[model samples]
Target: MQLEPGAVVEGRITRVTDFGAFIQFDNGETGLVHISQIAHSFVRNIHDHVREGESIEVKVLGRDERGRLDLSIKELLEEPEEVPRPRAIGRQSPQFEAKLRSFMRDAKERTTSGAPVKKSTSTKRKK
Candidate 1:
């Protein structure tokens, strides 16, 4: 059977490598599942996600110039739900506004007093 892009197929992982896994379909066609395409989360080790002789469903991404099949497992799976980030405890709006107001007041005082503003020394010096 011809494998088309976007086609989902079942295959057995023949070998697992640090970079990717080799899957052989029932039709004897083989494709590679890159480490990045193995899971929704970061894959430090390919074996952590999939093992040899394991059956998996993968989507055909497309074919390379040499007509080799390029497959992805994550594409066929639902994306992981995003977790809500926790709000910073000590940085509430009122506290931040108060600090901003204080800084502005100090800056206005320095400007009104005609005190020379200090120059920043972070810029690179020209040769």
Candidate 2:
């Protein structure tokens, strides 16, 4: 079967290396799941996570320029929990409509001034 980018498949471990593991895709294609991508944490060896002849499910990330496939096993194994984001820096906790009104007011003031509002000058130089 033709495999599209981001597709997932099951494959058997054909080889392992310091960098990655060679896997045989079920669709007659082969892929390498990089050691760094094997899991969320650092992996010292590919053999610790995969073994020869072991069937594993991996996500088809795509092929390299030389036609070798690149696969990912991390995303295939578990779904990460959604993170709760803290308030964005420099942004006040205000409703959307209130922020919009404030922005509009500032914009109107700048436009009606008819001149570039001077930002700053040496206080001693000012009359």
Model 1: CA > 4 A from native: 83-127
Model 2 residue 96 distance off true place after TM-score fit, in angstroms: 58
Give the alpha-carbon lDDT of every model.
Answer: 0.89, 0.81
Model 1 lDDT tens row, 1-127 = 6699999989999999999999999899999998988877777788888989999989999999999999999897788697335465875699899999999999899999988998879678789
lDDT of 2: 0.81
What TM-score do all the candidates reach, one by one?
0.63, 0.58
Displacement of the residue 125 alpha carbon in candidate 2, Å:
91
Tens digit per residue, CA lDDT, model 2, 1-127: 5566787777899988899988886667778899967987667667788888898888888888998888899877664565335455686557976989999999999989897886876667646
Misplaced by over 4 Å in model 2 are 79-127
Q: How many angstroms is residue 88 displaced in model 2 relative to the true structure, after the best TM-score fit?
A: 30
TM-score quality measure for candidate 1: 0.63
List CA RMSD, all candidates.
8.6, 10.2
